[model samples]
Target: MHKTLEGVQQSATPAIRGPLQVYLVVLALGLTVTAPSRLAQVIAAAVFLGLAIDAVGVRPLRWLAVPVFFLIPGLAIILVTTPGHGLIEFGPLTITQGGVKTVLDTLTRSGASIIVLGFLIASTPVSTVIATLRRAGLPSVLVELLLYVYRAIGTVFVEAERMQTAAKARVGYSNRRAKIRTTKLIASTLFLRTIDRVTHLDEAMRARGYAGKAPATAEAESHGYGLSIGILAVLLGVRIL
Candidate 1:
């Protein structure tokens, strides 16, 4: 996670302040949810995707595939299960026009929302995000917990990579059965290791007079949002009028 974040930080465009990014994401999501037609949803998705690509290049778009892949099963169910004028009949199942429309609508909305979130995460630093959340009235305890989880993701990913490399060196994934066993071993071992690490971390924090409050990080000041605000207004106008 940290390595990926470092790559994001190297992007050509500087990210806007976290609060502005949050507002942009929220507006994009609102437009997506209340979109009157599929065309409107597509426009919303396209605009935000273009923004994301512009800010961080194409690196972050790869994460979109994960959600899209997971949506396939649900979208397929909607395609086959929803009743309407039949588009196709195959093996006692009928794909309907209405079902197809529903699927497209779902896809567009999900794509738009995900793109907005991806852009926000890719552009903003984690500390800025935490500060934004705190400013938005999130409880300190929840924020602190979230911060720990965010940091832990990097640790877990690093450990997983190291384990996978070592396993590969030992022919851990040489066959199908071996692959399954190796994955299980890695997961179990990772869990135990994470627990140990967390225990030590807790001890370290306590030793340093850790408190229940979240540590304060300097928040990025808002600036240069005129263009973004104008673009967002135009998009909203397109959606509404």
Candidate 2:
């Protein structure tokens, strides 16, 4: 059973500094939004691409698909509907010069922003993100809410997945009606279980000393500030330039 016991052990992840990562994220987002020229936007895009490939690695493409979904629709709708003189017409569809420029500008800005933000998310742990939010003047209630939602969602998923798997084993979802009924049952069951779990958690917290406030979160490593500040300065400079 040595192999079984080994499989049960939780592994650790490398520590990333919380505040520094958050700072860079804010800077990257700010610059991405405010970048004055195409060249500046290109620079931001390059930074995002470089960060994804070098630091975040495999997650960028997968995460990027989410934003691209909305972005593509926005581009298509704008190009077809916006009224302007210069038309690049394709049958019933017509895109004006202004529409094309606006769409291109939007794509560059949004795609770059999404990539950099996704890099931040893929690299940082949840605990670090919560801690950063706490320190960044977010209300304690909101911070706790964020944490609670993350935890509760996981619990809900587990319950739902278990029920789904059990139904699948019995072929309870073999047909369309069966699938609909099973899904509703699964959702309702998950909702009830989540409420029960929250009640138990509340009691447990009262037993230990949770006086309606969130617990104190930890600070980031001392060394990360200088590097993070340097990065922020560069972004600000680029935005201005």
Cα RMSD to the true fold for all candidates: 6.0, 8.3
Residues 119-210, candidate 1: write the lDDT tens digits: 66656666666777788798988878867865564345446667777999999999999998987787667756766776787778778888
The per-model lDDT (C-alpha) reads: 0.70, 0.63
* Candidate 2, 59-114: lDDT as tens digits: 32353443464467678898778788767788887889888888888888887777
Misplaced by over 4 Å in model 1 are 1-3, 10-12, 138-218
Window of ten residues with lowest summed lDDT in model 1:
9-18
Please provide TM-scores, in order, for all candidate models, with all chains considered together. Answer: 0.67, 0.60
How many clashing residue pairs, candidate 1?
A: 0
TM-score computed on alpha carbons, candidate 2 = 0.60
